[model samples]
Target: MTLAVLLLVSSALPAQAASNRAKQRKLTDTQTLFTKAMRWGEFEQAWSVVDPKARESRGLTGLELSRYKQVEVTGYSEIGSMSEPDDIVVRVIEMRVVNRNTMAERTLRVRERWRWDEADGQWWLQDGLPDLWQGQ
Candidate 1:
């Protein structure tokens, strides 16, 4: 019985490890999509990643229209991430943005929430610009 129990535990360990890796990969993918949308000025693309409730609350259409203006994203760095069964919270350490004409770069630390929608088999932004580095 002891030998059988040990065998069962050994088999379970690999499955749990794989599950954790999958969750991490999903979180990374979600973060990548967000950065890509910002870099390309694809607000609609970004909006597509947002939860429906957040979309409505923030007037997604207006946000998309406003993003028609030119903007540049220099880089993104992941500060950390926390995982839930169906969601992930990521803290970005470095996000650099530049205005088209001003040629000035602004770097900020931002935190965002991403959700995994099992029904759609996709990950999406569930919240927005929750906090800035300097309270601005």
Candidate 2:
């Protein structure tokens, strides 16, 4: 009975590990799409990856989204990332932007928080859109 239990447990381990890898790949792909959209000033596409609840809470108006167009994303780099407890991941991204109106440039580090939603079967950006205007 002990050997049989051990065999079953050992068989399950590989499956669990593979599941984790698949989840990581999905997250990577989603992140890439979000990054690409942001880099190209496609806020609508990037907004699709954000957590629905977060979007709802923000009560974003059309003017709010139009603000993103005022700045051009010159560069975006992922500085670092850390996985926290409860299926949460935090990534630090350094973004360089130039204001279309003023031609002034600035670099800002944005913290992107992600959470795995089992019901949704995917990862969602917990942090809403980065406020490029914040502190400016």
Candidate 3:
């Protein structure tokens, strides 16, 4: 009886472990993509991570684009990550940078949010601070 119980427990362990690993990988991948997008000033690419409905509702365009450009000018340095299987957040230590024409540095902090996209089988941004899904 003890042997059978042990066997059953062992059998269930791998699946649970795999699921956790998958979730972590997804979160990491999302962070990497976001970092890359920021590094290159890919505002449209970054915006692609926003939930479709939010995109429609917010009508993010000119103002958002300008803000992203400001972020690009201030290069990002990742400070840390606060993440779970389903949600991942990154804190960036920013330094204000001159747009290829001058040289300067200023201090700032930027927080980004990420969440798993079940439908797309990937992870994506949850939009700006305060996140889209807060109460539920």
Best by TM-score: 2
Could you tell me which 10 consecutive residues in candidate 1 have the lowest summed lDDT?
127-136
Candidate closer to the true structure by lDDT (higher is better), 1 or 3 = 1
RMSD of each: 3.7, 1.0, 5.7
lDDT of 1 at 24: 71
Instruction: Estimate, for each residue in 1-136, the C-alpha lDDT of model 1 and write its tens digit.
Output: 9999999999999999997688678867866787787667666676677787777787655644654454576766777767655455555457777767787778877767777776776677777532322543
lDDT (0 to 1) per candidate: 0.68, 0.92, 0.61
- Give the CA lDDT, 0 to 100, for residue 89 in model 2: 91
Candidate 2 lDDT over residue span 41-121, tens digit each: 999989999999998998567997888989899999999999999999999999999999999999999999999998888
Which is the winner by TM-score between candidate 2 and candidate 3?
2
Model 1, global lDDT: 0.68
State every prediction's TM-score relative to the real structure. Answer: 0.69, 0.96, 0.68
Rank by TM-score (best first): 2, 1, 3
Question: What ranges in model 3 sit over 4 Å off?
Answer: 84-105, 129-136
Pairs with backbone N, CA or C atoms under 3 Å apart (clashes), candidate 2: none
Candidate 2, 107: how far from true, in Å?
0.3
Q: List the residue pairs that clash in candidate 1.
A: none
